[model samples]
Target: MDEQQRLAYWRANTALIRNLLIVWALVSLVFSILLVETLNKIQFFGVPFGFWMAQQGSILVFVVLIFIYAFQMDKLDQKYNNKK
Candidate 1:
């Protein structure tokens, strides 16, 4: 790829990472921690929503995010013609 293409690819990659990290932080920090008191009032599978999020939901979301990141990166690679 040319220098311009290289810059664009990096930019897209960085944006993807930023967006994913934002989602991770919101799930891990906001709903799980900051809003726990309020969220505890809600139910999820017979458990408190906040507790479920803190104990399992966050981990599940993180794992899902990993797959999403991989999938998105693959698309980005294809878009940038980075395949070997």
Candidate 2:
């Protein structure tokens, strides 16, 4: 690819990674810690929202999001001939 294309690809990849990281961080820190008090008042599936988020929900979401990101990035890599 040309310099411009290379720059664009890197920018896009960086943005995607950054956004995902922010989302993961929010789910981990905000819902899990920062808002735990308010979240404790809510319930989901017979468990406190904060408890579920800290122990299970966030981890599950992170796992699913990471796999989705990996799959999408693999396709992006293939499109850009970045994959062997």
Candidate 3:
């Protein structure tokens, strides 16, 4: 690819990373402080929704997000290198 294509690819990659980070932050905030009472109204197999989110859901999402970001970025890197 030419320089213009490379720049576009990088920009797209950066946007994906930023969007994922925002989603991660929102999930963290929801579990940590924002929607505790509303979340508590919904039960997950006898567990309080808020408590479950705080204790496990957020962590799981974060871990999954990390893997997803890593995998996507790795693919982008491989593509860029292959073009050379």
Against the reference, the lDDT scores of all candidates come to 0.96, 0.88, 0.85
What TM-score would every model get versus the actual structure? Answer: 0.97, 0.89, 0.80
Name the lDDT value of residue 70 in candidate 1: 98
* Candidate 3 minimal-lDDT segment of 10 residues: 75-84
Question: Considering lDDT, which of the candidate structures 1 and 2 is the better prediction for this target?
Answer: 1
Off by over 4 Å in 2: none
**Residue range with the least summed lDDT across 10 consecutive positions in model 2:** 75-84
Model 2, span 1-84: residue lDDT tens:
788877877887888889889999999999999998899999999999999999998989899888978987887787677755
lDDT of candidate 2 at residue 9, scale 0 to 100: 77
1 or 2, greater by TM-score: 1
| Whole-structure CA lDDT of model 2 | 0.88
How far out, in Å, is residue 20 in model 1? 0.4
Return the TM-score for candidate 2, rounded to 2 decimals.
0.89
For candidate 3, lDDT tens digit of each residue in 17-83?
8999898888889664699778989999799898888888899999999999989888887867744
| Model 1 worst lDDT window (10 residues) | 75-84
After superposition, the stretches of candidate 3 with alpha carbons farther than 4 Å from their true spots are: 82-84
